[model samples]
Target: MEYLILAIIGLASGIVGALVGLGGGVILVPATLFIGINLGMIDGITPQTVVGLSVVMMIFIGLASTLSYMKSKTIDYRSSLIFFAGSIPGTLLGAYVNKGLDLPSFNLYFGILLIILSTLLLVRKYLKPVEWFVKHGKKRSFTDATGETFVFGYPVWFALVLTFGVGFASGLFGIGGGSIIVPAMILLFLFPPHVAVGTSMFMVLLSAVVNSITHISLGNVPWLYTIPVIPAAYMGAKIGAALNQKMKSETLVFALRIILLLLGVRSIIDGIWG
Candidate 1:
């Protein structure tokens, strides 16, 4: 029954992940907490164990979604590499920090980040760029200039900084890091939303792998549980990607924001009251 519940959750998470370029960790964490509490795994050390296991499972989820994106040629390898360069080191540092932090503190900080990310997603529409400015303070005056400015996207330095922050956050929270990266790439990097989703999956894949290794080294992962969750997640990712092609961009963004907001609120409640 535990395995069955996890499988269902993995499928749902995979669909969300593939469609929005998230690792589904925001959903997974809370779901796992609910399940763990029900199963009486809420005792000392078990909640952390569930979190560690969930992170390990997300590594597989990211890989599966990345493969689907790669097959569709949606991944931007150059941008992914730049993001990975910073995220890899940050993930390692985050893993070490996770080892030292208490569970409540971890949950509280993680919840706060999610809330901030959710709010950002909710307000993205209103924050759309009205003008494009170059590093030299020159603003694009023409519509064509605006389009061209965003065509290839933001400068490489900006991408690097964004990636590093996402990676660090991923490590700190034991998540796939796509929640922050996908939105950041689309909103700040000026990449097409779909392309950002695909590219973010690739970055999540790499970061998850690094984080998984750290988790394993620390004996924090449960391989038995991860095995079933991973494959289901991959299959669900493919299905979600297909659906993404048929959805309106605005609708998808709105749905993602609502989901994030709910998850953020849930995490906060669980951290404080559970």
Candidate 2:
């Protein structure tokens, strides 16, 4: 019965994750806690265990999502490769560091990071308009506007540095790395929103895979929970990628931001009350 409940939560999370670039962390973590409580796993250390399990599950989710995007030709493989170059090592290091940290500290830091991510999502729309004006300057057909053109707008070295930081946080917090990578890609690398989402998903695939290994090494993941969620997440990703191509840019961004804010708030409240 508990597994059934978790599977349902996974199904809902998978759908939301597909629509947004989040790897279902916002849904998975809280759901895990709820299930853990019901299953008598709600010891003081349950949150950390939940995070570990979620990160492990995100590996499969990211891979499944990336495959769907890849089939649609939405993935920017070159950029993903560049991001992964830095992220792989960072994930390992983060996993090692996390293995030594206490659960309460991890929860506190995770909560703080979610709050920061929520603020970033909330402000992205306003910032984008300003950035669009600054970059395009009333010309929509500028080099940046050409959908066919791809450029590494940021210094490659700087982007690599940022990728490492983002990946480390992802590993530590059980996130998709999209929350950090998408904004960086848009603001720093000048990727279009859709491309940023696609590229970030690909990058997340690599980061999650690397991070999952670390979690496994630590014996922190719950396979019983993960096995049933993978296929549902994959299906969600397929539907999401298709929907993404049809949505207007402004509408998608607006919706994503609102969702992020609500999820973040819910997560914070759950953390406080749980």
Candidate 3:
């Protein structure tokens, strides 16, 4: 059954998503696309419809992941508030912008964007941008429930600017922006890897909420299908968070890179060949 297949995909998506910041919806879209096309169930599935359902799924997936990460005390609350400040307005703006876009153009640009992001992640070690971050004299730090302490510093202003774009991308593309944001936090802001994942998950919750509201208003969502996917993703998030606590930092980063790289390649293929 389609529902059974979606549930399985949703579970897998949640595990990888919470661990790396993909937010589960990323996995669902392609899977649904593939299945629907093959089964003739996707004839009514437009970009808007896919984005709407994805945002809805993202809302629950992110909330579930955030709760799990918070259990570990890995989420950065103060910074998360600032992230919400920027992401909220940006998500709304993205929906407005998305309304005028065509599917081919959207796929083409989105694909190109993914490839560029992948390249940035791959060459991050060799690239250094202008150091424009405002510093806290006292380092910002937090200890997770596991007693793992993470300390790091980033400019509040820089984060605000970055989150705005991240939110916009999430709305436009139906991703949680963790794929991009977590890498930016780790490589650019010097965040501890696990902390970055936790913080990104927190941000994902807020952005998905805002984006979901916008998409729902637009009537793009297929609630009937979305309902079955939620519980599996929720359970997967908990499992992923547990795995996150045990994985080595190097291994996490490697996995994230591979995910981003694969997303890039897939997006390009969709744009060029689909």
Task: Please state the error at residue 234 of candidate 1 in Å.
Answer: 1.7
Taken over the whole model, the C-alpha lDDT of each candidate is: 0.71, 0.66, 0.75
lDDT of 3: 0.75
How far does residue 256 in candidate 3 sit from its true spot (Å)?
A: 1.0
Model 2 poorest 10 in a row by lDDT: 137-146
Q: What lDDT tens digits, residue by residue, belong to model 3 across residues 1-104?
A: 66777678778878888887778656776556556653555456666777787788777778888888877777887777787787777788887777886666
Per-residue lDDT tens digits of candidate 2, residues 1-274?
A: 6566567666766666655666766667665665566355534336556667667667666776777777656677777888889888777777777666554455456656766766775676566433432343212211223355544444556667888888787777677677767766665555677777777777777777778778888887876767666666666666776677677656656766666566556555545654
Candidate 1, RMSD to the unseen true structure: 4.0
Question: Residue 114 in candidate 2 has what lDDT?
Answer: 64
Winning model by TM-score? 3
Q: What shift in Å separates residue 245 of candidate 1 from its native position after superposition? A: 1.7
Per-residue lDDT over 183-258 for candidate 1, one digit per residue giving the tens place of the 0 to 100 score: 7765665566767788888887777888878878888766666766777777887788877767766676777778
lDDT for model 1: 0.71
Candidate closer to the true structure by lDDT (higher is better), 1 or 2:
1
TM-scores for all candidates: the values are: 0.87, 0.82, 0.89
- Candidate 1: lDDT of 55? 70
Query: Which sequence of candidate numbers ranks them by lDDT, best first?
Result: 3, 1, 2
